[model samples]
Target chain A: MGYEEAFPPADMKWAGNAAKRFASPFVDVPHDRIDVDAIILSHAAVASGYTIRDFYEKPELGIHCVAYASAMYDLLPVTHWFFSLPWVTELGIRLEYKDTLPPIPAAGQEHVLKDPSDVDKIHVPDKNELDKGWTLPMFKRLYTYVQKNLGHTLVPISYGFDLVGAAAELCGVENFIMWTFTEEEAAKKLVRKYTETAVNGAEGLADTFGSAMLIVGSVLGNNDIFSDEAVKMYSADNMKYYVNQCFRKGAGPQVFYHLCGNHETDYKVFKDTLMWSPFTVIHAGYKARDPFPSALLKSEFQDRATCMGSVDTKLMIAPNPKAVYDQAKKQLLEGRDSKRGYILGTSCETPPYTIPGNIYALTRAARDFGTYGTW
Target chain B: MEVIMSDAVKELIGKRGLKVADVEEVVKNGKAIQKKGTNHYIASKMIGDVTAYAEYDLESGILKKKANVTSAYSHRIKLIKVDKLDEVSDYVMGSTPVHNATLQMEYMTVVRSGPGLATADGSVLMVEEYLATKTLAVAEGLFEKKRA
Candidate 1:
């Protein structure tokens, strides 16, 4: 199983509803005859109003299956892996980089960022092209480096989930929402086109560099833009259509649907549309209205879907380490009782304001209370 | 969950020098436990000038009865502790000093908001003492302008 892309393709009108389009990789990998079990699609959609069918042109690709794979090497030095492995055929790597959008100008010659929230972490104008032109070459470079260096661990180099909210920032919220209802056909065409461009780029890179796995993500689940009704009506069908097309294509890459928002109502729709049976992982803040009551979601999904994210991120920033620890403990206990897969994570991004002591508490709870079994 | 009086509460009662007999009648007469959600908020209310009771059955415990305060109200019991005599007396006596301290603190931390502060709506609130003082000052000609 592979995890879905957390990021989304720029200009996807219903990117917030992209979670609904999630397809499990386990289903598609066998169809595509790929030995790899998982894949990720960084945020690249097809042309306006076009479906995933239009992108891959075949129906065998598993572009919507979501699952999680190991990232054992992401935190380690790439050079070390190059020198160590001699028996493997290819190198697998996960690439993540910050965005570079120019700060909004307050006055002439003085650039002022509206929110001093992520002042230190963000830079200007280094964003992934929404056009999906550069991602292919980037993958090629990464794969080539891996193959030329040691030719080991080269299986599935999941690309990324790009800057979560970057696309919304590029094309303001109101315009994006209006595009969904007013220009539905055009929007679908654009998604299909962009998605194809990205897949083409990914495929070209894969063939050239001798890589297998494809990974992608960005913020497609944030609820600040479209409402649930609009998503269900316009976005859900398109997501399903695209995922179906990916299945038709012979792309061995598994699909992953990732996002970072509190979209509780869309869970059923996401599961239905993505068809995440037997394989895949759904990682987000599944904040049920009643935590004690909704503990069953963990058991119901089992290995098919793993709910991630730590207790609310606000706990740590509240200067309450105990709150963080307690939340983790509660989630693990809930997971154990429900017989479902649970991953320790934050509800959202690990903000710079977060205290390091509270962050470490997550590890402590996992160590103290974790066990290996469903629930 | 069983509710047990904490050691801090016991020490507090001891510090107040209250005995079980002091609240014997209140405990006997104070029926009906205040149902706070699922838990009981057992408390008692004083009816007469009696500050102490004759005797209390520590084993049988306080009697329980239906609440009769108001038709629309929920059931709530008036809790009577062996140490409530000192608690109530100290509470009533402490009020005057607390108010005095608050007044002193107000003077020390005065804010100038045009001599008035509005609430949620644009309605000004004037302190009753300030209003009375101002009215008296005007009656006594204390606020009158002198001849230039």
Candidate 2:
């Protein structure tokens, strides 16, 4: 194989934007002089994608830039790679970060009919006033703008799988779970509401970006926030409902599902979902004492899908490069036996604070052990 | 802003959803009523205004109050202060006050950690189970009073 790509392209201006939005304390590389093989356009405003394109277009520093778009499954900022077309290489989304979040659409542009039963459960206080149906058009505008101005692929976003957290946020976690057992009818109706909106959004993306894939997104692993019962009731069936209705019917681009937790329990949900075997599974962590081996997924879906990084971002910040190198080696060795489609990467988003030498070490490990033959 | 009630008085006040102040009013009723220490053998006159009271019963499980209805009664009936909010919360099983009534209660204990109740200190509560027949009797009497 060849050398694997290092994200946070050296030339891109993420620092200034990071500081502007996140109030990052450290200075980032100047956008004009940054260098990178590709760009993972995080889930943010329009300027993020443009900044990456401009870096590559500069006459002084030429590089190949791929626009990795975030999904719209929830309010969080995370990307989902939903295209199989050769022009858009699919790099899976991260669970720890945010997703592409556009402000709720303006009201009256389109009628967002609510299922009769879900009228009371819709949290947006004035549901009729929000532009629920116009997400597709706005996205189309974003795609058209990016493609025309920057010449990048209009990857249809696979958004809106963070329903578990969304539900918990709207209703406290204890009450949400309590509602399922106590208020059975109301709970079922709420789940149906969440699933239906997601399906509608999926149809919108598919309709706009015809050659696009669906990304089932989730933040299922926040202190077991995706409680077993919550997962069984809300996540499992709702995902099946949306994917079958919206994603499965679409043409072009194999669908991908992105999860942000260790996913210790939902592995079954991941393997069995109707979407195309994922193009990439990002951020499944590897712990030293996890009862089962990390290699288990390799045996199961390695041939069917691509496995992204497994090196824990926390482990990479060790004082020396050797520790980073050692951990990366361990991950490759564990994964090498499966030897199908493998992309050596961190178990979660590579934190910006990661040491550069360690980042280089990861690139080296992917080159060294990410190959098909003997390590 | 203080509300206090004994286990027996609180139960007479009903459990659906009542504040301490509401229970306190019932204990200090002006009408002549049977009072046995913390227990009130009979509370002939419901103390709080109808609007302030969430219709509920002290027995027949907490689930009985899931519905709402209103009835005017001119006469008062007898009630035994079998248990109060503190004693009921103590014996109610499971994680919540509602769950306690649903689950078995042989080994249940009252919440006693003073620092835990964010609203105040010394805010411990209890729960207790009456004899099986009295369970239904108390529930019947509470709803009976609702009609009167």
Candidate 3:
């Protein structure tokens, strides 16, 4: 396959604006628009009539989907590919795929790490060996595609599947949760194993793409789905401590905390420990399905983090773009003056078939109501 | 100007978000009432007025730092004395306390860490979180009676 494909000139004014927002969020630079990301992937594929299977199987199509969707919707702070299977599939778990559905681990599939003791099997793929896998080659092509075609410095973000949360999927999720309470020693040992994979994976991608905004997400391991006591026993208390080891191993300056769960119970765990990067954007998910109050996030994290506003993902699927616009405007109003910084985003990934009008409305609201302030 | 807190107490306190700065300020300036006869001192209620019953070595009339300043009550209830604020945080965090006992005896540990008082009915609490379970009015009352 020829590595080069023909493309037209892309509008990159949004990239420059986003770069300024990232570099000096609070500096009084003349930025008229705040950065907005729609998590616009599945919709991009749909625009091209390419299914979820094609995006993963055709590695080259991954960048094309992100590019087409980001440009189609004028999404800022452009991202390359985003999917969870590239991570889970490597664990020897069987995956079920369809035209409409993203690759998901098959139900009742035997977990590769069937027991906590099997944690010893999780070897971190060294830096050199990373590209031999499916994820890195796509990353190489993405960076090359961005630089070669657009002459733009695309900051491809790290994949969002956090190590500790992904580790549970490696060993059946239920089994791992039970082990945290019943077999404490074994669970912590597994944590170290997953931390290595996570750090090595980030190091590998950054090596491939030069630099990236490391998105360390810890959601499936949060207290809402898990118990508060167990979260302390393992996820919050242990995962955070081990993940910080990435800094010592050499990571990028920016870290995006995809804290995508109801954090009412364990917010302190993150407030106290999770943030280690100089440039941090903390994405708050929800408190009981409604958007976690942006004001509360601002209050707790504004001193140290750029709080991302959670425009509800359900709104993205709403027939009317006005619903998405109103939600984005509400988030912008409360989150705009966050002392540290603010970026508007959906509560999480916008569902696959989310209408394009809703995506554009999100950006329109961002420009209409976004903070027009110093850098 | 002279507050003598043992290194163990200092280390334990550090775990509860008390920096050396806060401890020095509270110890030097905060009122420390000696726990009756024990060398330990109960400093003025701090940290949301939860009343950290600092286990301290009392020097004459001065408040000196010690550990488990509440052995005074755990002394009576047959519960092990837990004067360390870290243990208070641990217990609040659902950690098994130093001494395992029946639920009744467990509640008996209602924080004898000096500043706290275990009531006749065994209902008082000192950890900041437990204080919020009551109404604002009742919470303020609990706050007032938090320190014996």
Top candidate (DockQ): 3
lDDT of 3 by residue, A179-200 (tens): 8778777777775666566566
- Candidates sorted on TM-score, descending: 3, 2, 1
Q: Which of candidates 1 and 3 reaches a greater DockQ? A: 3
Residue A156's C-alpha lDDT in candidate 3?
55
For every candidate, C-alpha RMSD to the true structure in Å: 29.6, 24.3, 14.6
User: Could you give candidate 3's per-residue lDDT for residues B65-111 as a string of tens digits?
Assistant: 32332211001212223221111222211122222111111112231
Each model's DockQ score = 0.00, 0.01, 0.01
Q: For residues A123-218, could you state the per-residue lDDT of candidate 1 as single tens digits?
A: 221113321333444344444543443232233343333222222222333444455566555444433333433344344543453323323332
Query: Each candidate's TM vs. the true structure?
Result: 0.42, 0.46, 0.66
Which candidate should be chosen as best, given lDDT against the real structure? 3
Candidate 1 Cα misplacement greater than 4 A, ranges: A1-132, A143-171, A208-223, A233-255, A275-279, A286-300, A316-318, A336-340, A352-354, A373-375, B1-148
